[model samples]
Target: MRQLLQRLNNNSLYVIISLLIFGKGLGFCLNRKFFFYPPQFAWLMNNVFLDYSMMIAGIGLLVYVCLPSNNNFVLGVLLAIITVLLAIITCIEIEHVIFAGEIEFVQNAISNSAIIGFILWTARHYSKR
Candidate 1:
């Protein structure tokens, strides 16, 4: 049991980061048909730009985690930042869902939860290290 827990802690970062990226891909997959984007975002100005910008930031954090030169401290900080950013985004999306009746908040909340879990897991792992 102890060894299994240790293994899980060591791999937590990779698991959470993969979930984050997978969430993004799932969004695109659900809203796309035959390689074409759904019309859902066509009415919003700069929607694609905003979406891609968020994706870039998420990918950049994943890249940082994957780099060999980083230690647990740096990785933990990055994870915290990503978690906070995702929390804020999740709140914004929640507000939109409440006021504007948008339906995409569920996925955003799931992503945010994963990010928050990652931060918590990182803290525990760092302490154990």
Candidate 2:
């Protein structure tokens, strides 16, 4: 059961992240025609900024996991934790978006993607060590 759960965790996480990013993209695409409001625009802008930041961090994480560096497992783990926390906080802000028009799908996508990416990256890198 534990092993099965671990396996599913990555898959589900991936789905969640895809959904979140998709939602955000959809929101940006539809903001003008569908949800034309200042708050919505601001939310989308904030979401984009946050995602860009996360993308940079995500790249660093990729390098950290893929490279044969020294014992940076602690740092790697910390980064993953931080990403998870960001996802949670982002989700709250996105909840309002969803209430307005189900744009929170992007949050789910972002969170799931980050979670799965970090977990698999860490597991593969560490297990090899």
Candidate 3:
């Protein structure tokens, strides 16, 4: 039963990550029309090439970690990178809020925080098993 729960948890994590990748891809393709945040946040979404690169990097790391003969050290490094990226993104949103004096992107900031929380939780959960 313990092993079965672990397997289910791992599969669900992958599904969540896969959905994030798909959503990022769709937003990249749609540009400003994606409308997750606002027009101000549109710049981040509009850069399709950069978005694609970041998304690919993340997914590639996940794939490498999930391979049959994967190295645990590499997986740990990937998780660290993911955590740092989430932190950087959250910081950027905070910086924007500080400089622009606009509360419009508050929702974006909160959403980034949630993503960071999710990533951190997943990292901790997987590290335990």
Q: Which candidate wins on lDDT? A: 3
Q: Order of candidates by lDDT, top first?
A: 3, 1, 2
Across 50-98, the per-residue lDDT of candidate 3 in tens digits comes to: 5565476567655554454446676667656655655665676676677
Question: How would you encode candidate 2's per-residue C-alpha lDDT over 1-129 as one tens digit per residue?
Answer: 674454435334333433444444445444444332346465554455555445545444444434444455654563555456455545654664566565745666575556556655644553323
Measured on C-alpha atoms, candidate 3 has an lDDT of 0.60
Where does candidate 2 clash, by residue pair? Answer: 16-108, 16-109, 17-109, 17-112, 17-113, 18-109, 20-105, 20-106, 20-107, 20-109
- Whichever of 1 and 3 has more TM-score, that candidate is 3
* Candidate 3 lDDT trough over 10 residues, lowest sum: 28-37
Could you tell me every candidate's TM-score relative to the true structure? 0.50, 0.42, 0.62
Off by over 4 Å in 1: 1-12, 22-50, 101-111, 126-129
* Regions of model 2 farther than 4 Å from truth: 1-48, 72-74, 85-94, 101-128
Name the lDDT of candidate 1. 0.55
> Candidate 2: global Cα-lDDT?
0.49
Query: Evaluated with TM-score, which candidate comes out highest?
Result: 3
The predicted structure with the larger lDDT, 2 or 3, is: 3
